[model samples]
Target chain A: MNNDYYSKSYMPGIIKWGKITMLLGITLCFLPALVISFVYGYMPPAAAILTGLLSQVSVSGAFYIVEPISYFPILGIPGTYLTFLSGNTSNMRVPCSSVAQEAADVEFGTEQGSIISTIGIAVSVMVGLVILTVGAVGGNAIVGMMPAGMKEALNYLLPALFGAVFGQFAISRPKLAAVAAVIAIGMTWLLRNGFLDFMPGKNPPSYLVILIAVFGSIFAGRLIYKKELQVPEEEKTEAK
Target chain B: METGKKYLEMANSPLMWIAAGIAVFVVLMQSVIFFRKSLKAAPEVGLTKKQVKMAIQSSAISSIGPSIVILVTMISLLVTMGAPVSWMRLSFIGSVNYEAMAAGFGAQAMGTDLQHLTPIAFSCGLWTMILGSLGWLIFTLLFADKMNKVNHLLSKGNERMVPIISAGAMLGAFANLAAGNFFTETNSLTIGSAPSLACVFGCGIMMVLTKVAKTKNIQWLKEWSFAIAMFSGMFVGYLAR
Candidate 1:
């Protein structure tokens, strides 16, 4: 009952034969994709087909990967294989899933998991595949019936959703939010400037920009809240 | 490649929800057992069990406010800028399904991709804001859910922290001398990184002011620094293309 039995170790154990299973499944999955891409001349197959199980590390490492891929079948095997192997599911989420759901409520324990609940998972996976096919083949056609401009503008949906997220945080502590904004901008600018350029690096400062912003914010957080030091309640801590 | 696509398809299949359901069930079952175990062996009657339950209740809904704010902020900007609805659905659904495939672009892609798609100029205003909002959400959320004793999502956290730290920093004086870069693809008027640095450093000053500076007086500094930083980001983003 204590799913601790689903440890991270199982993924690698599963991966011990990943290449074989994938290689075999490739003819079924990848080969057909290649044929389609060649016919349509889609060029590079839009990454969905180009990459296999490596999608976990290959992608941006956000949350909810499981939900979508699990529902979609084709996207699930590669990412789930790699990520599940590592016993980490964060790579598939919205990146801020915890902000909306608590650790305790979500059992956010980061312990590596194994393949313990195969039956329930397998059932869900089958259901997911049906929905994905129906959605992709039929949904696109039906949804594509919309105006081109409207369709184009629809791209903004996610950003708006994310904005809503920011707005919520801003409401929590407008002043602190404002401060974090300024610091993040400054650190971003500095990192993109000549300073890090002078230091040795291969990828350039752009990649490090996120890190700098985090540091600046953390530094600013400690400094600004220096006076309010105390043990946070477990409830409050879990909400973090 | 067909296999790649197949895998991706399989990954995205609704069937995979079974996996998630199972995982959820497994976790819930484990949690119940864990609580029961702790309760049975506890020094007191259900003390830790009560605490964990309390923790779950208090923590579960705490994220509602900030979480929605950031998501709304990002989604609004995207909507105003005319991004695709599919993209929007994908942002949330992408992860829920297999976000590892779409990545976070489902959140940050609106402005950049739209700009790239159209003949119109770029718009960084929403993008930077989107990035910040997402980053902020990530930081706050991680603290709540991560079971790892150590933190790994540290980079994004810094992005969120900067804004908080800058609430009190003073703006440094600077001249706009940008014929190219930062903002303005043609007008040549741009403060660029110069202003951004000032904005962040000013936040530092503001943090200092948060206490010593008169409470009423402190508010303006926070607003000013935030505005300048966001504006700078927008300019750079809108113009960078």
Candidate 2:
């Protein structure tokens, strides 16, 4: 079944389409900048542009590599393409994908899982764009009318989201979840105490905590569940 | 040239809207194409039509709360960056935190802030925001297809290990994100803080929802669990504060 799925040309075709869309996305990324700078004749000084670029890069340069790699296992190929292009990976895309897979009863990291995640991510991108468009048109008035308490609650959205997603996944693997949480919280404590100040900037780069936690849990999972993780050849064939 | 108000006028000009519209159009087109392709291919992967419908419905419903959060951020971005650029950036490869910081850096590089803006400084801010996000696109373009090899190597030729690896990564990533919220610059141990309490509440609610949904075979409850958990947590946090 695995061979049949890959050899059927669906995977390769999606990859090709993904690359094309991403290239188009890259070119489109420059449209607003190009139009404003050239057509409007408000070009910035070269030095200022360089200074601005460098400062932004200093903060986000590491994330460029770290985020895509870290997210690929969960997102798969087409979902990865849709996600990086659409933005809001962790907050929007990943959660959508996870929920879709669960709803469909698909196993993560499988071909079916990837297809379901792709559908989920695509739906999110469309829904998000529509909401953003509406918000752009009349958001100021809506925001002004919102109650103060609700506005304050919005501040906790990210934490609540992360916690809920963690809980969703943790129900299946309590041991691995506990181990991962300990490592992550410990890293956060170290970051807060200035122990990681030796790295760069006033604080260490935040991705370090993510890197340690992800790989650390993977290593721990392997050691703790080596036997269970191994698939018998007969069962594999039977599954097919 | 006049500076303060005129800069915003230019930022919100018709030409700026056209340019921003092009970017947003590209994003929409990509999503539509990918969605169609995946839905077509679903049956070959052994997914039922009913399952596909459920996936789409659940994901769309799941997106509402987060999209509202993004909408609030969009309002703030519109105030600082003007409607055109704010709409384009938020629709494309930009996040709420990154867009604000990049725009600030660009303005600062020109020796002015976002508030006291000049045309040139505005252009610089635009340039900075554009350039800051290019790295992710470029890196993904070069490496996304090749990542399959990395996955294979990680699994050491055991296909079954892939699911385990994926789960571990998800757990690890969420753990980092949730834990990060518990510590702020001003407060070290903020366990009882609104955001931290929200996290606790969200987790607790989800655990109960999932257990009930699974044991009782409540299909609709399973689908709506995330939104219910998230909003309940937010409400509890609001009341606590």
Worst 10 residues of 2 chain B by lDDT: B180-189
What docking tier does model 1 reach?
A: incorrect
Candidate 1 — what's its lDDT?
0.29
Per-residue lDDT for B202 in model 1? 31
The alpha-carbon deviation from the true structure for residue A34 of candidate 2, after best TM-score superposition, in angstroms, is: 1.2
| lDDT per residue (tens digit) for residues B50-138 in model 1 | 33343323222322222222232333333233222212222221223232222224222323343232211111221222222232123
Where model 2 places Cα greater than 4 Å from the true spot, the runs are A1-7, A231-240
Model 1 error, position A187 (Å): 4.6
Root mean square deviation (Cα) for candidate 2: 2.7
**Residues B1-241 of candidate 2: C-alpha lDDT, one tens digit per residue:** 3567788898888988898998888788888888888887888778899889878988998999999898899898887788989988988899888999999999999998888878888889999999889899898888888888888887898777786788788889899989977876663767887888889888888878877876787778767888888888888777776
Task: List all candidate RMSDs to the true structure.
Answer: 15.0, 2.7
Native interface contact recovery, all models:
0.01, 0.76
Candidate 2 residues A123-161, lDDT tens each?
A: 999899998998887758988988987788898877888
**Every model's DockQ:** 0.06, 0.69
